[model samples]
Target: MSTFIDIHALQTLPPSNINRDDTGAPKTATFGGVPRQRVSSQAWKSSIRQDFSESLDSSQLGLRTKRVAEKVVKQIEQLSEGYDKEKALSEVAAAFKTVGISLAEPKKKKNEEEDSTLESGYLLLLSNQQINRLAQAIVEANGEKLKKADVAKILDTQHSADIALFGRMLADAPDFNVDASCQVAHALGVHESEPEFDYYTAVDDVVKEAEESGAGMIGTVEMMSSTLYRYANINLNGLVKNLDDSEAAVAVAVQFIKSFITAMPTGKQNSFANRTLPEAVVVSLRDDRPVSYVNAFETPVKESAEHGRRYEAAKALAAEAQELSETYGMEPVKSYVLAVGDLKTALEGLGEETNLKVLLESLSTDLSKVLAN
Candidate 1:
């Protein structure tokens, strides 16, 4: 129910600049010989879940929870009037301050307090299998009673598992304990508005003639949509809390959410060459590869598109196809591989075979047929 985190932003974050060298502090590393700032697999996981929870309309968590709890304290303070209830609520509010969890806040207006984050994303820290494991732990903790789990699952939930553990957590923990954890899960089944995001590519309009007038024809092009999804799972029981295991609910949720992110409101992304998109050339071997499109059909490529604009086209198509493969059950991916190959072939054919008239015409038709509106 939210936009995919931007990998560019994720890659550029300054390494944990904090002075502390503690376990929870941010981490840094040198990737490709460049000093890179990194959110630990842990930090990355937590950040995403936090963001996803908000966009999905699940609930505000962390310090926000404390503020809301403070609001409740304020009400209790009024009810307490002259009674010790004021002191008790005050003390509880302080506990909330210590843990940074609360039950209330200066009420946000309707459609207010979105959890959208700018400039960052997960870079394959937690694999899908790992995400599932984390959800399992959280479910065990909730056990029809997050209150009674007695910190067993809390201890069990690791930093690496942060994305699913916290995001789908529907109940806000009120009791204090050794874990020092705060933040509520999205209230069971609250329609967390889905996370929405997009990436697009546009083929350019290119001309071969240095014109007092135009030449034979302009370069052919097309547009496409790209998306990369990291971890996604929904615990329906967590949201519904109908069963002892809240985490299991999200299994269905994860699929449903993944579907929402892709294949809905399909359209072409307008990213174009240089003026709109300075192309990044990339080359990949495609020979003898079995690629499938939406699992409707599949085939292997005759050659790897490389060494030119075709290379770049191949790269883009490859990236999108691989990404879509994760969620759409393979057919979409196959379709992508075919289009990219077809495009690469077309581009490579330029300047040969009579200005590539045949190739260009074939490519234009192929691009049009395979890429649907």
Candidate 2:
């Protein structure tokens, strides 16, 4: 298997807030002495993770939440006889103690209804299988009686595809932290871009024309339009090791690649229904270290000059990859390009041309063969 699987794509989004900052404007970053539209790595990765449910089975996924104690209690209540919520909470707390996690009382919120739900002090990254096994152990141990060895065995065998790819950091239990095998760069526009505001108002029909001439509500939202440059890298060895199954790891890699290439972040979708497919994608399988070609847009491609922003973005990316190989004497073992319309450039020369379905099949087969060797 190649040591790394790198994905680079170009997609154009119309005026929309696919990702927003604290002030509710579309995210922005300064590059080449100008502000450009930005979609954060967290936002894009979250979108990709959500898309996994559509393509992969529940068994291949992981759950991230602070209410782990509540989830575990539910499992325990189902499996163990004569265990109520209060008792289950105690049992799960004992299990957390084994793993060095504190089961704190659920923090009360002003707007939240009162309940007996409990949570871990921090978010727990856990797989379904791990949760079931831990619950079963608690039941077998008869609540608050699990031995250290039981906890050790449960934690050692915890395997999660999301946790493996995205990683988890435990501030209290650093030993349990998993290093992320997948790295995603923030998606940025291929051209210099700025935000524009959309002033809007809503009218109330209930009010009489004479009684209320003004609108019920008024607001302005910040948005932008541009072709984005997105990139990500996956470490095959690290993923397989984290998942503890080579075949499953390959399947996840394929699913993730397909999803990441196609998924759209759903921020302000109702207001701006701006979903779009990538204009072009370039996948590189390499044995050497990973490289990000985002710098290809440092000078920013211009729409008026390049005809369309996506076409020019594709051209710039292809040129950058070609130049990198020549300068560093590092050519990828294999490369694939998926493009739309007449936007094809020299990228076709650097790699084979394939559609998404064929690309997924070919990538899975190649990665599996490498794993076998």
Listed in order, each prediction's TM-score against the native is 0.26, 0.95
Off by over 4 Å in 2: 110-114, 207-213, 304-306
Q: Candidate 2: lDDT of 326?
A: 97
Cα RMSDs, all models: 19.4, 2.0
Q: How accurate is candidate 1 locally (lDDT)?
A: 0.28
For model 2, state the Cα shift of residue 325 in Å. 0.3
lDDT of 2 by residue, 31-134 (tens): 88889999999998888989986777776777889888778888887886668788778877877787687777787879988888677777888877778888
Task: Point out the worst 10-residue segment of candidate 1 by lDDT.
Answer: 5-14
Error of 2 at 353 (Å): 0.5
- Per-residue lDDT, model 1, residue 104, is 29
